[model samples]
Structures are given as C-alpha cells and as structure tokens.
Target: MAKTLEFAYETPQEVKVGDDETTFTLVCKNEGLPVDLTTAKLITVKIGSRDGYLREQPISIDSLSKLPTGQFKFNFDKDTLDNFPTGSYFLEVWVADDQGTSIYPSGNPLNFIVTANIENSSGATITTIAYDDFVKELNKAASTIVKGDKGDKGDKGDKGDKGDKGDTGATGIQGPKGDKGDKGDTGTTGPQGPQGATGPTGPKADKGDKGDTGTVDNAGLISAPAFHSLQTQVNNSAVGTNLITNSNFSSGLDHWKVNPGANSDCKAVVTTDSDGDTCIHITGTGDACGLYFGPVSFNQNQVTTASVLAKGIGTIWWIGLQSRPFSNFGTISTESYSKIGSIMQADSSSDTFCVYFNPVNNVVDIYIKFAKLELGSHATDWCPNSAEILTQSDYAKIKAAIVALGGSLS
Candidate 1:
C-alpha cells in the first residue's frame, strides 16, 4: 500500500498524419504515491500490424489527469489520431487507480514514433518534402519569380483621381449606326487606286452666230454673151469661112439663082401665106444680086429677040452670102438645087451650103459653094403660121458676114 502507483510515458516526439487532422502528444509519468487518481483510463491503444496489434476502439483519455507532481497529461485524441496508421505507432498506456479496476502501470517502454509530420505518400499530403529538397526549393522559388537583371522602368503611376464627373454619361444613347461592318473582306485590292487627280478647266464659251443663206432653183439662162459671140467667131477666122459667111439672109434676098422656067435654079423665091406664113419679094436683082444672092441667073431682052417665054416662078431660094471677092460669076447656077450634088469647096475660097428645107414639100435643097466672102442666109419659116421676123437689116448682114469670114466680131 505504500506504492500506490508508478507509471511513465510521453509521446509525440514526432507524429503527424493529415488530410484532415492528426497530432500526437501523450505524456504520462507517475512514479506513483501521491495517490488521488480517481479515474484515469486510456486502457488500451494499439493500432495496426506489428504482428497484428489490434484494439483501437477505445480512445477515452478523458483529457488526461493526475498531476500533483506526478506529471500526467495525456491529450492524444486529435480526432483519434486521425484514424491512425502512417507507421510505427505502438502506444499502450493503461492507468487506473481507486477501484475501477486495478492499474497496470507501464510507460517507459514507449517508443513514440508516428512520424509523418506533414508528409505522406498514398494518402496524399506531401508538399515536396525531399525530391532533392524539392528541387532545391523549386530552384529557390524560381529565382525570385523570374525576370532578372533588366531594371529601367518605373516612373509611371500618379495619375488617377479625377473621377466624379460621371453624371454626363447619359448622352450616349446614339449607338445604332453599326450595321455597315461586313465589307472588310476586300482588302488585298488596294494598291491600284492612286491615279485620279486631273479635273479643273471650265470657262470659255461665246462665239457662234452666222448661218443662213440657202435657196437656189432652176437658174438657167447663161449664154455667156452667146458663148462670147461664138467664141469670137471661132477665134477669128476660118471655121470654114465662118460657116458660109455667117448665113442668116433675107434683106433684099436672092443670091441663089438659076431659073429658066418652072424649075429655075438659083431662085431666091420664098413664099408663104394664108397662114402657111412666108415672105419673098426680092428685087435685089437677077439671081438675087451680090451682097448675097447670086449663084447666077437670067431673063432680060424680053420681046424683040423673041425670047418672050416667061414661066419663071418656081420658088425655092435661099441665098445669103457676105465674105466678098467673087470674080468669076458666070455659069454658076445651082440648078433647081435640091442639094445639087452636095457642094463642098472648103478653100479655093470656102463654099459650104448644105440646105434642106421642106416646108411641107415646098422643097429647097440648094447647097452651092465657092464662097470667098459672102454666103449668108436666113428665112426659116417652117410653115405653121410662121412669124419669126428677125431683121435688123438681117442683123447687119449677118454681122458683116461674120467680120468678112475672118471671124471675131465682138
């Protein structure tokens, strides 16, 4: 009875297992004898396999007690040591005094080792405990969180406090112009548009008013002075004695003559009346005399030589000569003259008479030649009531027989 008790034990030299919670501290030292232990029990504490050391269901150390210099404070719950098991934890502290059940005091046999002070492998709470000291503390915290020797950038931070003017923000209601945005895909075609700057020259207009003169119809009568007086008589001279001495006769008529009776040749007898129209009463003498008429003719010595045979009016005469100089004068009767063999003489003193007037068979084909200076005639009455008189002395004897057959009358 003198030795009331003797027990000794202290734990948690190092025991840590976590994920939720675990800690260890159990010290019970009582060399017994101060004896006021009325009920202290943690009677059994054994956890997993050191050859099957079971019994872990009773954890009631009751916050431990027994102190009066016996040193006992067993607080090992930590939620039951986090349901225990991270290695070597064999603790058995059975203590009881004062009649609940005898006590088995055993403490020094304690080998406290629940070592894992925040380190675990399969239950997971290892924060780089060793892998080469966690790669040298993660390379010294990544060399102070990366970015070394480049220092020059720091002076920009003092500009922020002007904030209270915000009430003017209500005017932003105009945001609706946004729908035109889709045309942007055409961008690669922009290098070709720079050539357009040349337009500024507009003001010089006032000069248009002068057009009105167009009306010409049927303007015809230009004989150009009768073709300039027939080209000045074919340039003065010899268009075959100026066409038989300018032809156009009828002044004292005659120059044709060769009449002996009824068919008297060279007779300048032209007649027309009762509207058949004509005129012929020459007296310009025998064969109609020289200024024109005579191809020659006769009738004189009337009653004594008994030559009284008168039947002389077979009319068909046209003699109009004028270029002068006719010396032969005898046997020149273009008999009855109906063309009298187509006279031609052109030179030995020019003679050309190609006549053919048939005032309805009042026949007159007298073409006599040999005209040197005078061969002009003109009685064109072509019957139908004839009245084409033209006579200013037969137009001055056909203009002096066209200037004596050497043309150029002007």
Candidate 2:
C-alpha cells in the first residue's frame, strides 16, 4: 500500500565552513512507518553539484547515522568534506524497500545555505538568533500561510431544520449480561425475601479442610505494575466463588440448616420483615436454641466474615452469625457501641462460619435477615447471590482498574 507522510527538516539555513559537529534532523510526522530503515540497506542522502531537481542520483555523501527516529543524519565532518570547495550544493535522501525499489519524497531544490569558508576572506561577525525570538518569528511566518484578514462578519444563515437522527442502526448482537449486579443503597439492609420451603438437607456436615490463612494482599504503587499485578491476582481470587448459599434467603432454607439448636423448640419459618425482605423467623421456647445455618467450607486460613440482620421479638435475644453475635441487628453500630454487630475475622480452615439465633432468652422469637457468610473479613454491600461472585460495584472497579492498567477481562 502507498503511504502518505509529512516530513520536516530541522536543519538551520547556514553552517560554518568547518562546523565538524553540527547535527540536524529530518522528522517523520507519523510513527507508523519504518522510515526506510531495514536490515539489508539504509536510507541514503547525497549532495548534488547543481541545484535543479536531480532526476538522477547525486554524488553520495558518506553513510549517515540511522537515528532512533528512523530518519537519517547527514554529517559533514572535517574529514568527509576536506577536499570539497566552499560553494552551494543540493541534497537528496532516498531509501530502498526489500524489493529493491527506491522510495523517497520528491526531490526539491534545497533552500539556500550560506557557508562560511576560506574563500570568503572577509572576517565575519556572528548574529544571534535568540530561541524565543526565532520562535516568535517562525510562528508569525507560519500564521501567514494559513490565515488572512477576517472578512466582514457574514450574516448568520437561516437555522436549518433539525435533521432526523440517522435511523437507529439495527441493534448489535446482545452482549453477555454484566457478571454482577450493583451494591445498592448501604444502610442496614432490611430482611431479604421470606425463606421459602426448606430444601432437603445437605449431606450431614462433613468435617472438611480448614481454610488457609491467605497472604495479605496490598496495592502497588501506580508506577510499579508488580504491585498492581499482585493485587489483581488477589482480587480475582476473592471474586471467584461465593461461600454463602441462599444469601438472600430467597430459596427458603435451601443451602441452610435452619434447625432449632440447643434447648430451642421452634422451626425456622420463611417470612418478610418490616424491611420487606425475605427472612427467617425463629420462634420457640428455648433458653439458647436458635436457627443454625452452615458449615461454610473455605480454604485453610482464608479469612471470612458472616453478616446477618437480627432483632428480638422479646426483651432479650441472642442473635449470632458465623458463630459470632452482632449485638444490635437493626441499629446503627455507632449509636450503642456496646450493642455491636460484625463478627471478628477468623480463618475458615479449622472452624466454619455459622449463623444462628441462639439468643439469650427463655422463649426467643427473633427475625434474621440476609445471612451472608462471605470470604472477606469485612462485609461489602449486599448483592443477591447468583452466577456472579462480585457485586456490580466490584465488577466495575476491577474492570476499570484492569483497563487502566492495560489489561483485559477474560
């Protein structure tokens, strides 16, 4: 294919007779081309004795340094031009492709060059071209090529009728649905849907492998991709599989063992709470027994936290989660610091994270909402469990971060 390129010369208009170390550039406007550089041959530059356009090759100057820019640098050092007389000269540059066909810009008559050589015996005085002054003059000259005096302001044309939007293109193929849903409003989430019929129990709780204590992952410096890469791995792992089954309690007690525990004598009932979310209603007489759900499996030492919203129908209640208790299941944690929620982080390796309503009461009737036992030590905003492990927010974050770091989702 033919290529179009804009080229510019960085050469000054004059050179001293013995300027042995002067360097100038021929820049490529686009980086897409190889600039005639190749393993078999180099782009060449030569000087011509006469100034008219050279239909033929000119006298070759010695080979030039192929610059990193892919352009060549023609040098006129003391040795290279020792015998040449001080006079006007023209230059031509050309390169050959693998096919041996030469490629080059149209040869133009080079701009005039004033050479200070021995032939001009008049001792010379140097004139200064301040960088700023040169730039200002250059800008002024450049502006003249593309600008002219503004014509008297033309009257505004009549407003054109709004063009109908181009017909909507046929819908493109539907993309796969986003992997996760958004982490919606974050307050104490109300109860999820009332538990549906308790499904057949899972195999009797198996004594399983204790989860491993995962290494603490840290974010890397934006400058250091290693850190980012490491954190990315960690994030990916965390986002793989969700441990909580029936997180929203939508399937009733499908993955849960909502049995009344020690001294309790009530069955776990699926019902909605004031918040209008499905929840488990545990009601029976027992000083301690309550609905228990889990034997959540995990990798050894993998930290996890269990969360549930709970409140008592009676004065005192023992609401527990992941074998831990959240003192006030419905109130802001800060209001009564003593009335706490959020279980301490623990490794799921040796012990399982369980949720139970073993409140401290004789006839305990408590409502438990959204029992979530997830992999992280902290609970993020709740999103219903499904095919996606991460929430919508999490999905967006990981995708954005990966893209920013020049990565792609698999």
Candidate 3:
C-alpha cells in the first residue's frame, strides 16, 4: 500500500521585525506501510498575498533523505518580506512525489498568515480583531471600513446696517473757561539750579558821629607812698609807740645819726636825754654801715652800733630823716655813696657836726647832725653846705636808689 502523509504550517502567531527568521514546519507522518521517503529530494512551500494569488517564488525543504519520522522544516530568510508593506500575507504548504511527475494527495494543505504587522516594533498596527479572524472580518460587508464621528456645525448671524450721518448745526459760543485745576503732586527733585548772577554794588554809607570820651582816673598818676601809712588804730596802740620810740637812740639828737670811725667798724646807739626826748646815734666809719635798715639781724663781729649809727645818720641828713624813708635804707651801699662817704658840714663853724642829706627828698630840713669836733675829722667834702642843699644829679641818684630798693619813686 502507498504511504499516507500528514502536514502542518507552523509559524509564530506574532513576531517583531528584525528578529530571527521564522521556521515553518511541513510535518509528514507515516501512517501506512513504511516507505523509502529518503529518495524524495524536495518538499515545496507556497506563500501568497491575502488576495489568494500564489507567490512567484516558492521555498523548498531539501535533504528529505535524512528526514526522520516523515517530518520536514524550512527556514525562510527574514529578508523575504523586507520590501513588503505592513499587512497580513498568507502562507500555503504542499508536497509532491520525489520524481516530480505527480502531486501527492497524502499531505493535506496547511495555511498561515504572514503578518507584517509586527507585535511591538515601530510602524506596527493594532486591530481589535484577533489575528486568526482577521481575514474573515476583513471580508465582512459592514465591518471592512471604519468612520469617525462627525464634529458639530457652527451658528450663523445677521448683517449690520450703516451708521447715520451727523448733523451740521451752528457753531455755539465758546464755553466759559473751566475752574482752575488742583495743583499737581510734587515730582522727584531735579539737579540743583545754577548759581545766580552777582548783585550790583550798593551806594557808600554816611560817616557815623564820634562817641563821647569816658571819665579819666588820676589815682594811677599819683605816686605810691615810700612807706605805707601806719594804720590809725595801730598808731594809737602801744605797739606803734614802741616801734617809733625804740628806733630813737638819743634825746638830744632830733634825727638818727651815722658816724663811721676810721677803722671801718661802727656802732648804733640809742639815747634818751634828761628831757625824755629820744635819738639814734651812730659812730664809726666804713662800708659796713652802707646797709642801715633791713630785716637782717646784726652779728657782733660784722656789725656794730657805730656802723649802724653812721648809716642812719647819713640817710637821715640826706632825706630829712623821715622814719618811712629810712625803712628801706638797707639797699644803700659804698658803691652808691663812695663819692660822699665823709660827713658833710652844713656851716663853716668847726664845732658843727657833719651830716648827710636825702637828696631825693628835696634836701630840705636837718635830717642828721654830729656832735662837736670831738666826734672826728670829717672825710673831706662829705657833707652838703646846707641841710636844704641837693644837686640835680644827687636827686636823680636817690630816685634810682629808691627804685632799686623796690620802692616806687614816682
């Protein structure tokens, strides 16, 4: 008996583009007597478009002599559908006798779809119909073409009329001016304005009248006393009496006297005569008697009563022997009186005592007097001719001396 063969077209239902090529199996099963099918040289596979026209080329499964259990597979190159558009195509498998002389009815025809609509690749298509039902639904009358819903229509409107022409009325009189507007708000300050031009010179003013002179004071012009006046209250006291009385050394002597001895030593003696009148008598001669009155205490070896008496007598005779005048007498020295150290006689009588005058005090009145000739030989021309005699030069010297003594001579 002849062998009966069964076949199937096996390809994936869905595949992506550019994947490995698909394999279609043309399965054959041996159901009758064993046949030497190894002699068959070719098994044919026919692919067609969905329109039912056969493809111009057919793929052959070769090497059937090595076919086992009557099964065969053919792997078509993936480039087979490179130029085809994305759509469904068809595959058909058939077989023929090894001699190519007759068709075999032993293998039933098998069908598959060549789907260019890749599963997930770009440009692939998605349809609601199942892949198996695609060809049937594509042929259905009402389902073949799909239409989208239509959009709504727009409304219409009426046309506008032309505007009326304006009237040409007489020109009315000009309206009254409007009320003044409110002041505008201040804006941001601008740059400072330029400096203003200089103003014109003004006319010269009249001279003002002179003012009255103020009253003049004569006190400054008057001389300050050589000695301050003894206060009237102090003068009335016993202290004042003691100061004046102790200053006097002799009652017969009306004023203090200075008599310097030849040895340059001196003595200052006070004498109260029987009449209770007082006097100061000095005896001796030298420079030691130059300073007669001062705050200094006398040492017994340096100062004697005679030297003090000579200086006191010299001062008194020159200035009328006023107590206040002699108060500052210590400033006199041999340098100031060297020209007139000898006692000066006021008269030609040899019995007359020699004396000195305070030339600065106008040389008036007797200031000091020596006793009779027993007193000593007078140092030549040492005395003034009279109590009132004073040269202009002597007055000047005395004035300067008072000033040197810190007394105001003015």
Per-residue lDDT of 58 in model 3: 44
Predicted candidate 2: what Cα RMSD to the true structure?
45.5
Which regions of candidate 1 fall more than 4 Å away from where they truly are?
1-193, 197-201, 204-279, 284-321, 324-410
Point out the higher-scoring one by TM-score: 1 or 2: 2
In terms of TM-score, the best-performing candidate is 2
Global lDDT of each candidate? 0.32, 0.46, 0.34
lDDT of 1 by residue, 160-270 (tens): 333232222222233468787655443232233334444444444444443454332212212223333444444433222222222233322334432332233334455
Models 1 onward score TM values of 0.16, 0.32, 0.23
Name the lDDT of candidate 1.
Answer: 0.32
Off by over 4 Å in 2: 1-242, 314-341, 348-351, 358-361, 386-410
Report the number of clashing residue pairs per model: 28, 25, 32
Weakest lDDT window of 10 consecutive positions for candidate 2: 331-340
Which RMSD values do the candidates have, in order? 82.9, 45.5, 76.0
Instruction: Give the Å shift of residue 407 in candidate 1.
Output: 50
Ranking by lDDT: 2, 3, 1
lDDT of 2 by residue, 1-410 (tens): 12212223224433556666765444321122445353425455555554444233321223334355444444565544544445445555555556673534332323223355644334565443455754555454444443334434434434434433333334335446887776545445344444344344334443444444333212222323343444445654763245666767888887666455555466678888666789877776553444455565545443344456656642222223343312122221212111213323344433443544333324556666665555533445565555535778888899999999999986
